[model samples]
Target chain A: MRRHTFTRFAEALPAAVLAACSGPQSPLDAGSDEAAGIAILSWVMFAAAGLILVAVLALAAAAARAPAEQPRWATREGWVVAAGLVFPIVMLSALLAWGLSITGGGGGASSPPAAFRIAVAGEQWWWRVTYLGPDGSALFSTANELRLPIGQRVEVDLTSADVIHSFWVPGLAGKLDMIPGHVNTLPLVAGRAGTWRGQCAEYCGGAHALMAFTVTALPAPDFERWMAAQAAPAAEPDNAEGRRGRALFLASGCGACHAVRGTPASGTIGPDLTHVGGRPTIGAGLLPTQRGTLAAWIVDPGHLKPEVRMPPFPVFRGEDLRALAAWLESLR
Target chain B: MRRTLVILGLLVALGAVGALLFAWSGLYNVAASVPHWPPTRWLIEFGLENSVETHARGIEVPPLDDPALVHAGLGHYEGACQPCHGAPGQPPNPLVRRMLPEPPYLPGQELRWSPAQLFWIVRHGLKYTGMPAWVAEHRDDEIWAMVAALLRLPELDDAGYRRLLASGARMPAGESARLLAAVGPAGEALVACARCHGLTGAGGGAGAFPALAGQSREYLMASLKAYALGTRASGFMQPVAGALDDEQMGRLADHYAAMPTPPVRPAPNAATERGRAIAERGLPERGIPACVTCHGGNALARNRLFPRLDGQHAFYLAQQLRLFAVGTRGGTAFAELMQATTHGLDEAEIRAVAAYYAARGRPR
Candidate 1:
């Protein structure tokens, strides 16, 4: 029975591994033009590697089957010239040129002009994404999430607020470093409208492993609508509980580090919360955005994301905490 | 050779048994009157001094020359230390001299030990002796203040001592009669508190004390209970509050809470603009909350447990904030929030915020 189970597991393992290569976060999934080019380059390299493996295996097989003496064609000198010396140089040089053509065409500082630019500042363990207008003025800012218009090349001006962090969206483009005091640009052109997961590729301080974001590529009209909505002030809470929560939030020190535009709570230390209710995740994608998750986050942010700068509000309890979280969720 | 070795081992075992029996017999002198032999006394003294020196090695002493700090230390010394360790000219009571390990007179102590060593000894008192560890274990600031006074003792004559203590108000005579005449029935049990806080709770002795008048009843009660439980680190208030029963604590809280607030001190110079900014808006970039959100007079914050900061002494507020930064200022359960909030503030910001609050009068 155990042998049968092992046989089944071995058969399924290859399929599972292949499946893993095509997910929301997989480079091979290739949601953007840049990523598709990378995918083709990757496949070509893999094919070359497979051909080399087959040739080496065939030579070994022939050597094992042949008599003690080998033929002149299979001698050390002949193999060295064909496989060892000539093969690597030719294969590597080809792969390098191909890889460069794919990455360099749309990558680096001197790439073609983008339709619009966005500024992404890497904080300790979070991303502060600011959407810029055509004139380079900031339209609105959000945290840990990016919204892009599909089929249009959007340039991302990346820099670090504190330390070095690498911005990586595997399905969109290659990773780029966000170095402190230096701006590095990454051009992204989404070929399809979908959500792709991104993560901090570099090891920042504590909570870096939890620092993740999502890029939503939308149709131009939808993207425009999202920007307009995000730029507007937070809506007034309609319910009594939400109104109470707003009062409690200002009364408690939530306004000190987080800002909700067009309110007395205009703090710039932490993320903007004008459209927090529309977000799919909070705490920089540490938890799914919901009332329960939001409440847990507010009461104990460090518990959810270690070394978080936001202090815990253990004083909020039961109905008060619930009301506060609901009000925040209603901010959209 | 084997027989001889066996005999030697037996002899060693026998000696061990004999020593055990001797200890069990209880024939040795154990009375306080019967002083230790010279060797035993030397060994204990050696161990005590060495232990203090070892533990006190890394303690960094702050500047102790401030006149206000020395003055405040003198205030605590008069009530807490003088009774046991005796001042320069005043000898301890005749009965106190009879204790097993007698407390030493504190004058000229700097000649014998460094300020750090004295701090360690005072903070963690002699274990076997009658000397008790400080009531508030987390309050190193208060203990350091005491050390500053101890360092000054060798030079202070009795006249100087009296002069330094002149600012500390004396308790009124006839407890009930005076208490009734002062702040009414609530003041009846506040004789010890009034020594520094004054009868009406208008804090006295420059900025050394914090004014308690016009504070909320809930805050006052919580503070008193915290001190009694030793959660709040104040060596001065711990023992006083610990001695009071629940009812007495309630009355004391009520007494101070109902007392009318004193007139606001004149605002400091325009240099406090930085402080005003911090108090109103906070250093948001550093993740520090605005002091006005909860403690401001204009905030009208609903959390009654958070004490009113307006008109409080700037020096006292600044010192408390410094203590909070180091996680040494233990207070009510909500105080942890202050610890988190103040963690990012620099020294200049702390001073500025304190000054802003101290000059602002009366919580609305």
Candidate 2:
């Protein structure tokens, strides 16, 4: 197959390229625009790197074959000036502008349609996600990970209580800060349906590095179903284990720090346990949200975050712990 | 060349002999009475502190939020900590003072610790310190609640403390009271603690629970967080504070801080007065840090991992000296740096130290 005129084919293209060119492309061939961009950028970067390497090899060959000369700092400076200063500044500015064209920030302008508002408050080592979406019909609240439809635009409001913090997702866009005293907004447009990793970029304190979450972009219907489930009021525990856990949680002052939309555990000092069972990890994604790990965290809280505000539950051992853990897990 | 070599050899031999003689002669007092020489003291302190700080830099900590974790911590505190540390308005047993480093007034946490620093100290108990590492094998959530409890403890009064302490103090207090507040608690934790910590912020102090009123907000706030997260190592508070949130902590801190700083009695002797001057004023001319720099940075923020010296138990401060020397009593990351300032002091100094701090005129 013939390559495009723009293709500086120093060598023949691959068999995959030959196959790809054999038929008219399908409508879904390239996936989303972001995926397309990623593919193109990867090729461009590889080509540029190959060309540079070849040029360097040629120069090295010439030098080896030719006579040696006294080293001059002037030549070094000129080369560095062109490659480091002139070339980088030009290339980076163009790339930055191009990136903005893809995801608007710093003069690039586009706002997420204010469909729903979620206020994310950063705590000692976890995230408290509160949905201010329309009451029962459109509301959604979850922790650690944030979910949205693949094609829809979402705005995240960020802020912290103790120190400076940042929000970042490697696959989507750049990092942004969640400073104290004021709120900041960032728009996210995920182009494909996949679970993208999100992490807290700023070092707020002792456990800064472990902070992580996911940006799950789902098909529209799945996303809607998730939202609806989230908005629905939390389940009232009736099963033996769950009833016991809820009672234990409240009796132990869990109500003092947390809130369950439908329950009497109405303290707002911590996360809303109204739907804790749905979360994959506890303690802001620090530990896996399994019964045993949950039990351990419930009992101590010290090993995980030293000097942490949460105290240990020494009194509950054996079945008391099991019943309480079972109850919290039932809050789904 | 021979002369040079001879001189070098003699110097080495003389140094070795000098060291041997010193060791054999019992010239250097290992007793707490005599302080280590300044240079040696600095080396030891630097090594210990630098090691801990450097090591702690890598551990990952997540943001704190766990309702269940906090709940469990509360129950743990009621059973384990109230006996020694006391609750809001509840004072610790006077006998605890007889043990080195008397248990601090639990509710007045502002003078206790910084959140992160507390975690580190808790994980690694100090040497020669009475403060024990947490009993729970994996103590993440419990620590956070203890922090929450510490924040809340300061505001609770005797009635409140008892209510929180009891395993069955529910709001409605009867069958068919199925408000979310009356959610099922199958085990010991199925009970409410607000009865003791108080619906309002007032906690116990005059009774079994130490009165949290007028204690350091900073200490109370940070210590609560530390205790919950197990950063502030304790038999109980770690679990209790672990169960709360920033709002509860704020509420607790505010409630207790608003209470009056307990009135101060005059020191029993002039020595205590002198100690007070040392703590408040410091030996600035002698390159000593003001005890208040860390302690009194902010009465509310005293929990920056520094226990409040003002109105603390004198005997407690003295025992803390031995712990601080060994690197145990839970402290902030910079706690070891605190040692250099103390290495120069004798046991007499340690006793005078607490007297001065404990004698601070009153909580403000």
Candidate 3:
């Protein structure tokens, strides 16, 4: 009985790990049509590869078991032509066709002409996502996080500020390189409402591993509401602590790099933090957005993500840090 | 053996020619705009890691738990290191971020190095990287202080760090103009005094600096003159005093003397008792005189030049006593008297007396 239990646990271990991988961010958990198509292609390739491996192994084993003196079914030349040339050509052609069909079937043609469009700029270790209004002007700006409406095709215009960086949302769309001085367009449609993960596929610098973002696909109405809220300036802090924090933020030279929309923090050096409080993560997805984590990040961003642009504030202490954190959180 | 040798020689010749050809080809991209190939990058990183690890081995780390050391380090870091390394709640300069090998933010990076390795890297700096060596080579103590601060950096929040920076002597606002006016010919030079002595003359914490508040105007003036005339030797204070004339010196002395003194709050413990005993009673066997004879509040009226010791930082008092015993701190003629009085007292006795005086009643 003990052995049986141990065996069961051992067998279940891999399945358990695989199950854990099916998180909101997992590529295997396809929440969008694009991701599902990729998944299907992946399974097909896996099955084909498995069959090829089994066939090759079986042939080798059968050949070894057969007597050397036994007559061959066909000459060595015939076998080589059949297995290496003909088999590969047929299988590869089929796989290529499938891949082309999946990729060539662009989501834009099927979607409405008035699709939501966003421009995502890849920085050294972060994403600068801007939503565009009808007139092609930026409606609002956010960093490290992208929000899309479910069942709506969205076009993302990708570009890079410095070195080359590839934007990849494995759960939503294929990887696309964001090259400096060039813009690449990627259209994605989320068939379901869920959160997915996006990461910088290219190695940009010291913090490339830490460069990640969340893609939350909400219902059409909810996404519109979120966009509207993001477009507005940050609300006035409600409490005395928050007010003090806002003052600290301004006084401490935070406004010189980050923007809070309504505030005088109109600097363009860092991310737009107008609706930062509502975001699920901060520091380019290096940390979850919580009061404690936000405070810690403000205190020392380099600690959380090495080589980050944000400097630590060794000058703020106690009530000031708390107040600043509260005020930032209240931005939502 | 002959055949092997010939083949080896030919291979070496061919390898050299190949290398020469490659060097002259100009096919290798040397652009800073692009990163090295993965293998090349890995090799360089590997070399750096091993070199740092090897050189950092066996370095004895000093006890870095002292808050005072951390405070001092924070001050130095803010002024010198913060531009590139950055502190909590600030970002590095934008131009600095564009460097090829970007400087890592120290808060998270501090954990990667051992305290001793940090010291080594800080003092010697990494070769080929933008990190610079320490300007003051002999100040290992200051470097250690910085290491101490780095060790605690991961745990410190912005507020905690700011508090550490603010722990030292604070300058009083609205007094610079008055001070400048008081020392007419001195002009802006008087402002430098506040950097160490503070605008209110309260001194840095725990007597790392001496409190100038409530000190006799005559003593202050005499000390400045001694410093100016080379009668007293202090590497830190001599330069400032040497630059001033007698009138300017007198005005600065008066300015500090007139400033309001801070309240005394000494730690009360067994040390305080021993300190009080040493101050009140003479060590008859050791031929040590009671401190009250010269420095007590009761004796202040008799000698106008005697500096008031009450409510002064113990650290400063103990340090002065040690300096007097060593005959390095030469003050006015009365300094000899201090040397003689302090000659017989041991380090512990001196500490006790300093602590006692530090906890004594406010300066009259």
Candidate number of the best TM-score: 1
lDDT of 2 at B141: 41
Write the number of the candidate with greater DockQ, choosing between 2 and 3.
Answer: 2
Tens digits of per-residue lDDT, candidate 3, B1-364, equal 9999999999999999999999899988776668778898889889988888899898888777755567556656765677888888776678777766777877644388888888988888887678887654445555787888788777877887776665334435555566667667765655666544566677663344567877889889988888787777653455568788877777788878887755555547675988877676656334355566556554555456678888887766876888777756677656755664577679898888887877764432
Q: Largest DockQ belongs to which candidate?
A: 1
- Whole-model Cα lDDT per candidate? 0.81, 0.59, 0.76
Assign candidate 1 its CAPRI class: acceptable
Interface root-mean-square deviation, candidate 1:
2.1
Please provide TM-scores, in order, for all candidate models, with all chains considered together: 0.87, 0.44, 0.50
Give the interface RMSD of candidate 3.
27.3
Candidate 1 chain B, which ten residues in sequence have the lowest lDDT sum?
B167-176
Per-residue lDDT of model 2, residues B137-199, tens digit only: 344444655655555666667777555555222334343233223323311221223333332
**Against the true chain A, what TM-score does chain A of candidate 1 give?**
0.91
Q: What is the TM-score of chain B alone in each candidate?
A: 0.86, 0.40, 0.60
For each candidate, the DockQ is: 0.41, 0.01, 0.00
Compute fnat per model: 0.46, 0.00, 0.00
All models, RMSD in angstroms: 4.3, 19.7, 27.7
| lDDT of candidate 1 at residue A2, scale 0 to 100 | 48
Better of 2 and 3 by lDDT: 3
